[model samples]
Target: MVFIQKGNNPLLAVKAFVQGIGLLGNPKLRKFVLIPVLINFLVYGVAFALGYLYLADIIDQFIPGWLQWLRWILWPLFFISFFIAGFFTFTVLANLIAAPFYGMLSAAALALLSGESATITEAPWPKVIKAELNRAAYLGSRAIPLVILSIIPGINVLAPVLWALFGAWGMALEYLAYPLENAGILFSEQRKLIGGVRWGALSFGGLAAAGLALPLINIIVAPAAVIAATIYVREIETDNAR
Candidate 1:
Protein backbone atom coordinates (compact mmCIF):
# COMPACT_ATOMS: atom_id res chain seq x y z
CA MET A 1 0.00 0.00 0.00
CA VAL A 2 1.48 3.37 -1.05
CA PHE A 3 0.35 6.70 0.42
CA ILE A 4 1.47 10.12 -0.67
CA GLN A 5 2.16 13.01 1.68
CA LYS A 6 -0.94 14.96 2.62
CA GLY A 7 -2.42 17.11 -0.18
CA ASN A 8 -0.29 15.32 -2.74
CA ASN A 9 -3.06 13.72 -4.77
CA PRO A 10 -0.89 13.90 -7.87
CA LEU A 11 1.86 11.85 -6.26
CA LEU A 12 -0.64 9.43 -4.88
CA ALA A 13 -1.87 8.79 -8.38
CA VAL A 14 1.61 8.77 -9.85
CA LYS A 15 2.92 6.30 -7.28
CA ALA A 16 0.07 3.96 -7.98
CA PHE A 17 0.61 4.29 -11.71
CA VAL A 18 4.31 3.62 -11.33
CA GLN A 19 3.81 0.80 -8.82
CA GLY A 20 1.46 -1.04 -11.17
CA ILE A 21 3.83 -0.72 -14.11
CA GLY A 22 6.78 -1.39 -11.87
CA LEU A 23 5.22 -4.71 -11.00
CA LEU A 24 6.66 -6.08 -14.24
CA GLY A 25 10.10 -6.23 -12.61
CA ASN A 26 9.04 -8.62 -9.87
CA PRO A 27 8.79 -12.08 -11.35
CA LYS A 28 6.72 -13.15 -8.33
CA LEU A 29 4.04 -10.61 -9.26
CA ARG A 30 3.77 -12.15 -12.71
CA LYS A 31 2.45 -15.38 -11.23
CA PHE A 32 -0.35 -13.52 -9.47
CA VAL A 33 -1.29 -11.52 -12.58
CA LEU A 34 -1.75 -14.59 -14.73
CA ILE A 35 -4.73 -16.01 -12.81
CA PRO A 36 -6.71 -12.82 -13.21
CA VAL A 37 -5.57 -12.66 -16.81
CA LEU A 38 -7.13 -16.06 -17.32
CA ILE A 39 -10.28 -14.86 -15.59
CA ASN A 40 -10.46 -11.83 -17.90
CA PHE A 41 -10.13 -14.12 -20.88
CA LEU A 42 -12.92 -16.33 -19.61
CA VAL A 43 -15.28 -13.48 -18.73
CA TYR A 44 -14.65 -11.63 -21.99
CA GLY A 45 -15.14 -14.85 -23.87
CA VAL A 46 -18.76 -15.07 -22.79
CA ALA A 47 -19.27 -11.34 -23.27
CA PHE A 48 -17.84 -11.51 -26.79
CA ALA A 49 -20.15 -14.30 -27.79
CA LEU A 50 -23.11 -12.31 -26.59
CA GLY A 51 -21.72 -9.01 -27.79
CA TYR A 52 -23.71 -8.83 -31.01
CA LEU A 53 -26.85 -10.09 -29.39
CA TYR A 54 -26.64 -7.54 -26.63
CA LEU A 55 -25.87 -4.75 -29.10
CA ALA A 56 -28.83 -5.54 -31.36
CA ASP A 57 -31.12 -5.72 -28.37
CA ILE A 58 -29.92 -2.41 -27.04
CA ILE A 59 -30.36 -0.64 -30.38
CA ASP A 60 -33.60 -2.32 -31.31
CA GLN A 61 -35.32 -2.18 -27.95
CA PHE A 62 -33.70 0.71 -26.15
CA ILE A 63 -32.80 2.90 -29.12
CA PRO A 64 -35.38 4.89 -31.03
CA GLY A 65 -36.18 4.16 -34.68
CA TRP A 66 -34.97 7.63 -35.64
CA LEU A 67 -31.52 6.33 -34.82
CA GLN A 68 -32.05 3.15 -36.86
CA TRP A 69 -30.69 4.63 -40.06
CA LEU A 70 -27.45 5.26 -38.21
CA ARG A 71 -26.46 1.60 -37.88
CA TRP A 72 -22.92 2.61 -38.75
CA ILE A 73 -23.06 5.22 -36.03
CA LEU A 74 -24.98 2.97 -33.69
CA TRP A 75 -22.70 0.03 -34.38
CA PRO A 76 -19.55 1.74 -33.23
CA LEU A 77 -21.28 3.49 -30.37
CA PHE A 78 -22.76 0.26 -29.15
CA PHE A 79 -19.42 -1.42 -29.61
CA ILE A 80 -17.98 1.12 -27.22
CA SER A 81 -21.02 0.57 -25.08
CA PHE A 82 -20.20 -3.12 -25.14
CA PHE A 83 -16.78 -2.21 -23.83
CA ILE A 84 -18.39 -0.12 -21.09
CA ALA A 85 -20.79 -2.92 -20.50
CA GLY A 86 -17.83 -5.24 -20.53
CA PHE A 87 -16.15 -3.06 -17.92
CA PHE A 88 -18.94 -3.00 -15.37
CA THR A 89 -20.69 -6.17 -16.42
CA PHE A 90 -17.66 -8.36 -16.48
CA THR A 91 -15.77 -6.71 -13.62
CA VAL A 92 -17.95 -8.20 -10.95
CA LEU A 93 -18.12 -11.41 -12.90
CA ALA A 94 -14.37 -11.57 -13.11
CA ASN A 95 -13.90 -10.68 -9.47
CA LEU A 96 -16.29 -13.35 -8.29
CA ILE A 97 -14.43 -15.98 -10.22
CA ALA A 98 -10.90 -14.78 -9.62
CA ALA A 99 -11.11 -13.35 -6.12
CA PRO A 100 -10.61 -16.70 -4.45
CA PHE A 101 -7.51 -17.55 -6.43
CA TYR A 102 -6.27 -13.98 -6.32
CA GLY A 103 -6.48 -13.64 -2.55
CA MET A 104 -2.99 -15.09 -2.19
CA LEU A 105 -1.84 -12.76 -4.94
CA SER A 106 -3.37 -9.89 -3.04
CA ALA A 107 -1.71 -11.09 0.13
CA ALA A 108 1.59 -11.59 -1.63
CA ALA A 109 1.42 -8.11 -3.08
CA LEU A 110 0.70 -6.73 0.36
CA ALA A 111 3.70 -8.55 1.81
CA LEU A 112 5.86 -7.38 -1.06
CA LEU A 113 4.69 -3.80 -0.44
CA SER A 114 5.84 -4.01 3.18
CA GLY A 115 9.21 -5.56 2.25
CA GLU A 116 8.24 -8.80 3.95
CA SER A 117 8.36 -12.22 2.43
CA ALA A 118 4.92 -13.71 1.80
CA THR A 119 4.25 -16.79 3.87
CA ILE A 120 1.84 -19.55 3.06
CA THR A 121 -0.92 -20.55 5.44
CA GLU A 122 -1.93 -23.98 6.67
CA ALA A 123 -5.52 -23.26 5.67
CA PRO A 124 -7.06 -25.77 3.32
CA TRP A 125 -7.55 -24.96 -0.34
CA PRO A 126 -11.34 -25.02 -0.33
CA LYS A 127 -11.56 -22.68 2.65
CA VAL A 128 -9.22 -20.19 1.04
CA ILE A 129 -11.19 -20.36 -2.19
CA LYS A 130 -14.45 -19.81 -0.37
CA ALA A 131 -13.07 -16.87 1.59
CA GLU A 132 -11.77 -15.09 -1.51
CA LEU A 133 -14.99 -15.51 -3.49
CA ASN A 134 -16.90 -14.16 -0.52
CA ARG A 135 -14.58 -11.17 -0.23
CA ALA A 136 -14.84 -10.39 -3.95
CA ALA A 137 -18.62 -10.79 -3.88
CA TYR A 138 -18.91 -8.54 -0.86
CA LEU A 139 -17.36 -5.79 -2.95
CA GLY A 140 -18.76 -6.83 -6.32
CA SER A 141 -22.34 -6.78 -5.07
CA ARG A 142 -22.02 -3.08 -4.32
CA ALA A 143 -21.41 -2.36 -8.01
CA ILE A 144 -24.75 -3.80 -9.08
CA PRO A 145 -26.10 -0.32 -9.59
CA LEU A 146 -23.28 0.45 -12.00
CA VAL A 147 -24.08 -2.74 -13.86
CA ILE A 148 -27.73 -1.78 -14.09
CA LEU A 149 -26.96 1.78 -15.11
CA SER A 150 -24.85 0.54 -17.99
CA ILE A 151 -27.89 -1.14 -19.53
CA ILE A 152 -30.33 1.71 -19.02
CA PRO A 153 -30.84 4.29 -21.79
CA GLY A 154 -30.85 8.09 -21.40
CA ILE A 155 -28.96 7.73 -18.12
CA ASN A 156 -26.44 5.45 -19.79
CA VAL A 157 -24.46 8.48 -20.84
CA LEU A 158 -23.97 9.05 -17.15
CA ALA A 159 -22.68 5.52 -16.74
CA PRO A 160 -19.18 6.43 -17.84
CA VAL A 161 -19.01 9.26 -15.36
CA LEU A 162 -20.38 7.02 -12.67
CA TRP A 163 -17.93 4.38 -13.74
CA ALA A 164 -15.05 6.80 -13.42
CA LEU A 165 -16.23 8.16 -10.09
CA PHE A 166 -17.73 5.24 -8.24
CA GLY A 167 -15.66 2.81 -10.18
CA ALA A 168 -12.54 4.30 -8.62
CA TRP A 169 -14.19 4.33 -5.22
CA GLY A 170 -15.28 0.74 -5.61
CA MET A 171 -11.92 -0.48 -6.81
CA ALA A 172 -10.25 1.18 -3.84
CA LEU A 173 -12.28 -0.88 -1.44
CA GLU A 174 -12.49 -3.99 -3.56
CA TYR A 175 -8.85 -4.42 -4.43
CA LEU A 176 -7.75 -3.30 -1.00
CA ALA A 177 -9.68 -6.17 0.52
CA TYR A 178 -6.68 -8.38 1.15
CA PRO A 179 -4.58 -5.89 3.06
CA LEU A 180 -7.55 -4.36 4.82
CA GLU A 181 -8.91 -7.75 5.72
CA ASN A 182 -5.51 -8.72 7.01
CA ALA A 183 -5.64 -5.69 9.27
CA GLY A 184 -9.10 -6.79 10.43
CA ILE A 185 -10.83 -3.83 8.81
CA LEU A 186 -14.31 -4.37 7.47
CA PHE A 187 -15.93 -2.48 4.63
CA SER A 188 -17.25 0.28 6.90
CA GLU A 189 -13.87 0.90 8.53
CA GLN A 190 -12.20 0.64 5.16
CA ARG A 191 -14.45 3.40 3.86
CA LYS A 192 -13.78 5.59 6.91
CA LEU A 193 -10.00 5.18 6.71
CA ILE A 194 -10.06 5.79 2.96
CA GLY A 195 -12.34 8.79 3.51
CA GLY A 196 -9.47 10.52 5.35
CA VAL A 197 -7.84 11.30 2.02
CA ARG A 198 -10.87 10.89 -0.20
CA TRP A 199 -9.48 12.62 -3.23
CA GLY A 200 -6.27 10.66 -3.05
CA ALA A 201 -8.13 7.37 -2.79
CA LEU A 202 -10.45 8.31 -5.62
CA SER A 203 -7.53 9.53 -7.67
CA PHE A 204 -5.92 6.14 -7.25
CA GLY A 205 -9.14 4.45 -8.32
CA GLY A 206 -9.90 6.93 -11.12
CA LEU A 207 -6.55 6.15 -12.73
CA ALA A 208 -7.35 2.46 -12.72
CA ALA A 209 -10.86 3.20 -13.99
CA ALA A 210 -9.45 5.18 -16.87
CA GLY A 211 -7.37 2.22 -17.90
CA LEU A 212 -10.37 -0.02 -17.37
CA ALA A 213 -12.53 2.01 -19.75
CA LEU A 214 -9.98 1.78 -22.49
CA PRO A 215 -9.47 -1.09 -24.91
CA LEU A 216 -6.57 -3.59 -24.73
CA ILE A 217 -5.34 -2.15 -21.43
CA ASN A 218 -8.66 -2.89 -19.74
CA ILE A 219 -7.78 -6.52 -19.23
CA ILE A 220 -4.96 -5.72 -16.86
CA VAL A 221 -7.13 -3.44 -14.73
CA ALA A 222 -8.05 -5.93 -11.96
CA PRO A 223 -4.65 -7.40 -11.22
CA ALA A 224 -3.13 -3.97 -11.56
CA ALA A 225 -5.72 -2.62 -9.14
CA VAL A 226 -5.08 -5.32 -6.54
CA ILE A 227 -1.38 -4.55 -6.69
CA ALA A 228 -2.02 -0.82 -6.72
CA ALA A 229 -4.49 -1.00 -3.85
CA THR A 230 -2.05 -3.04 -1.77
CA ILE A 231 0.68 -0.44 -2.29
CA TYR A 232 -1.81 2.35 -1.66
CA VAL A 233 -3.22 1.18 1.67
CA ARG A 234 0.16 0.07 3.00
CA GLU A 235 1.64 3.46 2.17
CA ILE A 236 -1.11 5.26 4.02
CA GLU A 237 -0.50 3.15 7.10
CA THR A 238 3.23 3.63 6.81
CA ASP A 239 2.82 7.38 6.66
CA ASN A 240 0.48 7.42 9.64
CA ALA A 241 2.98 5.43 11.71
CA ARG A 242 5.49 8.29 11.41
Candidate 2:
Protein backbone atom coordinates (compact mmCIF):
# COMPACT_ATOMS: atom_id res chain seq x y z
CA MET A 1 0.00 0.00 0.00
CA VAL A 2 1.10 3.57 -0.64
CA PHE A 3 0.56 4.25 3.01
CA ILE A 4 3.31 1.79 3.93
CA GLN A 5 5.79 3.09 1.37
CA LYS A 6 8.97 4.74 2.64
CA GLY A 7 8.03 8.34 3.40
CA ASN A 8 11.45 9.75 2.49
CA ASN A 9 11.30 8.81 -1.16
CA PRO A 10 10.58 11.90 -3.27
CA LEU A 11 9.29 9.83 -6.16
CA LEU A 12 6.44 8.73 -3.93
CA ALA A 13 5.31 12.24 -3.04
CA VAL A 14 2.75 12.41 -5.81
CA LYS A 15 1.27 9.09 -4.81
CA ALA A 16 1.01 10.26 -1.23
CA PHE A 17 -1.03 13.24 -2.41
CA VAL A 18 -3.39 11.00 -4.34
CA GLN A 19 -3.66 8.65 -1.39
CA GLY A 20 -4.44 11.45 1.04
CA ILE A 21 -7.68 12.13 -0.79
CA GLY A 22 -8.74 8.60 -0.14
CA LEU A 23 -8.08 8.91 3.57
CA LEU A 24 -10.22 12.00 4.02
CA GLY A 25 -12.85 9.98 2.18
CA ASN A 26 -15.63 12.17 3.49
CA PRO A 27 -18.22 14.49 1.87
CA LYS A 28 -18.65 16.73 4.88
CA LEU A 29 -15.93 19.25 4.09
CA ARG A 30 -17.17 19.40 0.51
CA LYS A 31 -20.59 20.42 1.72
CA PHE A 32 -19.04 22.96 4.05
CA VAL A 33 -17.18 24.71 1.19
CA LEU A 34 -20.15 24.41 -1.14
CA ILE A 35 -22.58 26.07 1.23
CA PRO A 36 -20.50 29.19 1.71
CA VAL A 37 -19.59 29.42 -1.95
CA LEU A 38 -23.25 29.18 -2.85
CA ILE A 39 -24.16 31.89 -0.43
CA ASN A 40 -21.47 34.19 -1.79
CA PHE A 41 -22.60 33.54 -5.33
CA LEU A 42 -26.17 34.44 -4.47
CA VAL A 43 -25.16 37.53 -2.54
CA TYR A 44 -22.93 38.76 -5.37
CA GLY A 45 -25.61 38.04 -7.92
CA VAL A 46 -28.15 40.13 -6.03
CA ALA A 47 -25.71 43.00 -5.54
CA PHE A 48 -24.81 42.95 -9.23
CA ALA A 49 -28.46 43.04 -10.25
CA LEU A 50 -29.34 45.84 -7.85
CA GLY A 51 -26.31 47.93 -8.73
CA TYR A 52 -26.95 47.54 -12.45
CA LEU A 53 -30.57 48.66 -11.96
CA TYR A 54 -29.61 51.68 -9.86
CA LEU A 55 -26.94 52.75 -12.32
CA ALA A 56 -28.89 52.01 -15.53
CA ASP A 57 -29.99 55.62 -16.24
CA ILE A 58 -26.68 57.22 -15.12
CA ILE A 59 -24.63 54.73 -17.17
CA ASP A 60 -26.58 55.41 -20.37
CA GLN A 61 -26.10 59.18 -20.02
CA PHE A 62 -22.43 59.25 -18.89
CA ILE A 63 -21.01 56.46 -21.02
CA PRO A 64 -20.29 57.46 -24.65
CA GLY A 65 -22.06 55.60 -27.47
CA TRP A 66 -18.79 54.03 -28.68
CA LEU A 67 -17.79 53.30 -25.10
CA GLN A 68 -20.75 50.89 -25.07
CA TRP A 69 -18.28 48.49 -26.73
CA LEU A 70 -16.81 48.14 -23.24
CA ARG A 71 -19.71 45.82 -22.50
CA TRP A 72 -17.32 43.06 -23.58
CA ILE A 73 -14.96 43.99 -20.79
CA LEU A 74 -17.66 44.74 -18.21
CA TRP A 75 -19.51 41.46 -18.71
CA PRO A 76 -16.39 39.35 -18.25
CA LEU A 77 -15.27 41.45 -15.29
CA PHE A 78 -18.65 41.05 -13.66
CA PHE A 79 -18.60 37.27 -13.93
CA ILE A 80 -14.97 37.15 -12.86
CA SER A 81 -15.80 39.07 -9.73
CA PHE A 82 -18.52 36.61 -8.81
CA PHE A 83 -16.18 33.71 -9.45
CA ILE A 84 -13.51 35.22 -7.24
CA ALA A 85 -15.94 36.00 -4.49
CA GLY A 86 -17.26 32.45 -4.49
CA PHE A 87 -13.77 30.99 -4.52
CA PHE A 88 -12.59 33.18 -1.67
CA THR A 89 -15.61 32.36 0.44
CA PHE A 90 -15.14 28.68 -0.22
CA THR A 91 -11.43 28.82 0.55
CA VAL A 92 -11.94 30.54 3.92
CA LEU A 93 -14.53 28.05 5.04
CA ALA A 94 -12.45 25.12 3.82
CA ASN A 95 -9.45 26.24 5.85
CA LEU A 96 -11.40 26.65 9.04
CA ILE A 97 -13.09 23.26 8.68
CA ALA A 98 -9.87 21.56 7.66
CA ALA A 99 -7.65 23.04 10.40
CA PRO A 100 -8.77 20.72 13.16
CA PHE A 101 -8.40 17.63 11.02
CA TYR A 102 -5.08 18.92 9.78
CA GLY A 103 -3.93 19.35 13.36
CA MET A 104 -5.00 15.85 14.33
CA LEU A 105 -3.47 14.29 11.24
CA SER A 106 -0.24 16.21 11.76
CA ALA A 107 -0.18 14.94 15.31
CA ALA A 108 -0.82 11.41 14.14
CA ALA A 109 1.98 11.67 11.58
CA LEU A 110 4.42 12.56 14.38
CA ALA A 111 3.00 9.86 16.57
CA LEU A 112 4.17 7.32 13.98
CA LEU A 113 7.69 8.31 14.92
CA SER A 114 6.86 7.56 18.52
CA GLY A 115 7.05 11.24 19.24
CA GLU A 116 4.36 12.26 21.67
CA SER A 117 1.14 13.49 20.11
CA ALA A 118 0.11 14.97 23.47
CA THR A 119 0.48 18.59 22.48
CA ILE A 120 -2.64 18.09 20.37
CA THR A 121 -4.38 17.48 23.66
CA GLU A 122 -2.07 19.39 26.02
CA ALA A 123 -1.49 22.67 24.14
CA PRO A 124 -3.54 22.81 20.96
CA TRP A 125 -4.02 26.54 20.32
CA PRO A 126 -0.44 27.66 20.93
CA LYS A 127 0.94 24.90 18.76
CA VAL A 128 -1.48 25.77 16.00
CA ILE A 129 -0.51 29.45 16.14
CA LYS A 130 3.19 28.61 16.20
CA ALA A 131 2.85 26.36 13.16
CA GLU A 132 0.99 29.08 11.29
CA LEU A 133 3.65 31.65 12.16
CA ASN A 134 6.50 29.36 11.19
CA ARG A 135 4.78 28.60 7.90
CA ALA A 136 4.37 32.32 7.23
CA ALA A 137 8.03 32.93 8.02
CA TYR A 138 9.19 30.05 5.88
CA LEU A 139 7.19 31.19 2.86
CA GLY A 140 8.14 34.84 3.33
CA SER A 141 11.85 33.94 3.47
CA ARG A 142 11.63 31.96 0.23
CA ALA A 143 9.48 34.39 -1.75
CA ILE A 144 12.27 36.62 -3.08
CA PRO A 145 14.60 33.70 -3.77
CA LEU A 146 11.87 31.85 -5.65
CA VAL A 147 11.09 34.90 -7.77
CA ILE A 148 14.78 35.36 -8.64
CA LEU A 149 15.20 31.68 -9.40
CA SER A 150 12.25 31.83 -11.78
CA ILE A 151 14.05 34.47 -13.84
CA ILE A 152 17.38 32.64 -14.21
CA PRO A 153 18.61 31.41 -17.61
CA GLY A 154 19.39 27.70 -17.15
CA ILE A 155 17.90 27.61 -13.65
CA ASN A 156 14.51 28.01 -15.28
CA VAL A 157 14.94 24.48 -16.64
CA LEU A 158 15.15 23.14 -13.10
CA ALA A 159 12.28 25.25 -11.77
CA PRO A 160 9.64 22.52 -11.74
CA VAL A 161 11.81 20.09 -9.79
CA LEU A 162 12.85 22.82 -7.42
CA TRP A 163 9.25 23.87 -7.00
CA ALA A 164 8.19 20.36 -6.18
CA LEU A 165 11.10 19.80 -3.82
CA PHE A 166 10.76 23.07 -1.94
CA GLY A 167 6.99 22.89 -1.82
CA ALA A 168 7.17 19.43 -0.28
CA TRP A 169 9.76 20.52 2.29
CA GLY A 170 7.77 23.56 3.43
CA MET A 171 4.52 21.64 3.67
CA ALA A 172 6.12 18.75 5.54
CA LEU A 173 7.67 21.08 8.08
CA GLU A 174 4.39 22.91 8.57
CA TYR A 175 2.31 19.77 8.99
CA LEU A 176 4.70 17.77 11.15
CA ALA A 177 6.28 20.38 13.43
CA TYR A 178 3.12 21.42 15.24
CA PRO A 179 2.60 18.15 17.07
CA LEU A 180 6.29 17.84 17.93
CA GLU A 181 6.50 21.35 19.39
CA ASN A 182 3.27 20.96 21.29
CA ALA A 183 4.85 18.13 23.25
CA GLY A 184 7.18 20.70 24.84
CA ILE A 185 9.82 20.32 22.18
CA LEU A 186 11.22 23.69 21.08
CA PHE A 187 11.18 24.72 17.42
CA SER A 188 14.97 24.66 17.14
CA GLU A 189 15.06 21.23 18.72
CA GLN A 190 12.84 19.99 15.88
CA ARG A 191 15.73 20.46 13.42
CA LYS A 192 17.59 17.66 15.14
CA LEU A 193 14.54 15.61 16.09
CA ILE A 194 13.28 15.37 12.56
CA GLY A 195 16.73 15.20 11.00
CA GLY A 196 16.63 11.94 9.10
CA VAL A 197 12.87 12.00 8.67
CA ARG A 198 12.76 15.23 6.69
CA TRP A 199 12.93 13.53 3.31
CA GLY A 200 10.05 11.26 4.23
CA ALA A 201 7.87 14.14 5.32
CA LEU A 202 8.79 15.99 2.12
CA SER A 203 7.87 13.04 0.00
CA PHE A 204 4.47 12.79 1.61
CA GLY A 205 3.79 16.49 1.19
CA GLY A 206 4.92 16.58 -2.43
CA LEU A 207 2.53 13.82 -3.31
CA ALA A 208 -0.22 15.51 -1.38
CA ALA A 209 0.33 18.73 -3.32
CA ALA A 210 0.18 16.87 -6.59
CA GLY A 211 -3.14 15.40 -5.59
CA LEU A 212 -4.40 18.83 -4.65
CA ALA A 213 -3.57 20.00 -8.17
CA LEU A 214 -5.63 17.35 -9.86
CA PRO A 215 -8.92 18.28 -11.57
CA LEU A 216 -12.17 17.48 -9.76
CA ILE A 217 -10.36 15.10 -7.41
CA ASN A 218 -8.70 17.92 -5.48
CA ILE A 219 -11.69 18.72 -3.32
CA ILE A 220 -10.84 16.13 -0.68
CA VAL A 221 -7.08 16.26 -1.10
CA ALA A 222 -6.47 18.85 1.61
CA PRO A 223 -7.67 16.85 4.59
CA ALA A 224 -6.43 13.59 3.15
CA ALA A 225 -2.97 15.04 2.78
CA VAL A 226 -3.00 16.06 6.42
CA ILE A 227 -3.93 12.57 7.58
CA ALA A 228 -1.35 10.93 5.37
CA ALA A 229 1.32 13.25 6.68
CA THR A 230 0.26 12.36 10.19
CA ILE A 231 0.54 8.67 9.38
CA TYR A 232 3.89 9.03 7.65
CA VAL A 233 5.37 11.02 10.53
CA ARG A 234 4.11 8.53 13.06
CA GLU A 235 5.66 5.68 11.12
CA ILE A 236 8.95 7.49 10.82
CA GLU A 237 9.15 8.03 14.57
CA THR A 238 8.35 4.37 15.11
CA ASP A 239 11.10 3.20 12.79
CA ASN A 240 13.54 5.67 14.28
CA ALA A 241 13.04 4.28 17.75
CA ARG A 242 13.77 0.77 16.53
TM-score each candidate: 0.75, 0.54
Best by lDDT: 1
Question: Which pairs, if any, clash in model 1?
Answer: 1-230, 1-231, 1-232, 1-234, 1-235, 2-231, 2-232, 3-235
- lDDT of candidate 1 over 46-75, digit per residue (tens): 776776466666645645667667656445
Winning model by TM-score? 1
Query: In model 2, what lDDT does residue 90 have?
Result: 38
Candidate 2: list runs displaced more than 4 Å.
1-22, 26-101, 105-127, 152-155, 178-184
Instruction: Count the clashes in each prediction.
Output: 8, 15
Q: For model 2, how does the per-residue alpha-carbon lDDT over 1-242 read when each residue is reduced to its tens digit?
A: 01233555664545545454454433333432343334434444554465557544533443356656765544343333333233323333343434544555455444433534334332366555665555556555764575455434334444455656666665565545544544455656665555455666666656655554443444555555665555554555555556
- Scored against the true structure, residue 234 in model 2 reaches a CA lDDT of 50
Whole-model lDDT per candidate: 0.66, 0.49
> How many angstroms is residue 147 displaced in model 2 relative to the true structure, after the best TM-score fit?
0.6
